[model samples]
Target: MAVEGGMKCVKFLVFFFNFIFWVCGVALIAIGIYVQVALGKALVVSGGSSAGTPVAILVLGVIIFFISFFGCCGAWKESYCMVTTFAVLLSIIFLVEIAAAIAGYVFKDKVRSVLKEGLQEAMNKYEEDPTLTEALDELQRKFKCCGANNYTDWANIKQFQANDTVPRSCCRINTTTCNVHPSPETVYEEGCQESIEAWMKKNILIVAAVALGIAFFEILGIIFACCLMRGIRSGYEVM
Candidate 1:
């Protein structure tokens, strides 16, 4: 009776942990998609070598979602094979996430260069691609920034003449009436690279915090799953 009671407790704990794990996987996927589409695509179009950090997170989230199902079903059914598979898969994912986190931190300094180059590339074709145009406009407006270096950087674009005005995105206040004329005193003198770098740094810290929290929960899940599997084996041996 005591063994049966212990097994029941183990099952409940494993199920509960897996359920939360599954939900977190889903949340990660959602956030990953948002980051990739909203933030990554812009940089990719600009000349970034990779689709950026969001793509990695998206892939990890997908893998986690599938593996979490194994854990959920295994715990619910008390299946040894499924539970073992879940543990192995979890271990692999844990290692991959750790590696990815480390890589992101190590390469952090290069991130600004990538973003700067990409933003510059986008500025050249901003008029040609409506999507790029809107994205750049939104970025500049939101950050209250101008070109990669400053307002005059727009003057160097081959597509524009020596004296062509910058995009209205560089304006201190964007409106239909806002002047995009090349006037140093009228527009936002701040550059976008600094703002983008700052934003990336803040987001990196946030993602790290979230990853650490999920990792803590996953450790608990692995422990409960192993315990439940042992209990199941013991019960069978007794019978």
Candidate 2:
């Protein structure tokens, strides 16, 4: 009877963990979509190689979402085969996530170069492409920054060269003179590259924390699924 009770407990744990997994899958999907949309905007402006990150996240989220549903079904039915399969799939996903985390850490250094190149391309094409122009202006206003490096960087752009003016987005205040005759006090002196890099670095910790938390829950779910699989295989009276 104790053995049966223990098996029942394990079964309950498996079901509970699967529920958490389902919620986590939903959260991941939402976060992935948000990141994809945000990156899409940046990619349109910069034309960088960052399209993969969000897509991978989105794919992983979908996979997890489906896997969690399978796990829940396995737990509810107390099916040894299904529970074992869920454990195996979860383990594989965990490993993939680990590899992704390592790759992200290793490639983090490339962010600066990508940002630099993209910002420069946008600035150079500012006059030729209306989309690029709007993107650059939005970037400047969002980051409270002026140009790729500084307000002086605008001097190199042909369109701005004629009027000797920066975009109105660079202004600290809404004034015509701020664009035509920008001074350190009237315009953002910081560069978009620096501002954006700083913002990313600051938010990276939050992202890491969330990832770690999710990983912990995934490990727990795998363990509970394995236990339930063993119980079901032993023909334990968990019901």
Candidate 3:
């Protein structure tokens, strides 16, 4: 009677919130994706990244916000099917993202700094003796990696190290270069920093995939609850 009607009313509210939560989740992911695209090619990041960091933070934040949103909806809907789905999704995303944020906030920065230092050194060296092409040639034997002709190829340093034996000379960009890190007399201490940054980057993507899984389930559980109740006739009618 009164209790039955009250319970149905609660479920209706729960369903509404569940839909809203999923919508938010979708928005966050969309924004995050946009941020990633914009930041990927940023060249002159005065503060580090032209845009990626803030977007990443926003993405994680939105994901977390929606997780709670859907969880609440599931609980209100009074369906373990929904609650369990939401909980599992939340738990997995929480664990993985926390791990990634810790890793990214820690080790990845180190790689970026080192790579920048190395590139700075290379840039200086190039300016000093751009005409002294032979000096550039000698640079090949010094640092065993491939790079763009007159600039630092910080992006592809890993390929050089991918062997049982280290490269005997700079990886030939075409047929001209043997010297490496011909920037300045600083930065290029030993290895390129891109290696660490690239390695960590792959892991960060994994975190996002886990988060997406959670968001997907958030939508699923609510619809399940709706279906569960929809066919039940009226609770007052009884089975």
By lDDT, the best candidate is 2
| TM-score of model 1 (CA atoms) | 0.83
Worst 10-residue stretch by lDDT in candidate 2? 37-46
Worst 10 residues of 3 by lDDT: 38-47
Off by over 4 Å in 1: 37-41, 46-52, 125-134, 159-161, 174-185, 235-239
Q: Which candidate wins on TM-score? A: 2
The whole-model C-alpha lDDT of candidate 2 against the native structure comes to: 0.82
Question: Deviation in angstroms for 155 in model 3?
Answer: 20
Error of 2 at 174 (Å): 1.4
Q: TM-score, each model?
A: 0.83, 0.90, 0.35
Which residue pairs overlap in candidate 2's backbone? none
Task: Please provide, for model 3 over 1-239, each residue's C-alpha lDDT reduced to its tens digit, 9 standing for 90 to 100.
Answer: 76566556545655555565566566567656755553332222212443356476566657656665766655565555665666566556656766865786687566476455544444334435443223333433333323333224533344333332122234433333323334333223243334324444755686567555655554455454454354333333211
lDDT, residue 159, model 2: 88
Ten residues in a row with the worst lDDT in model 1?
41-50
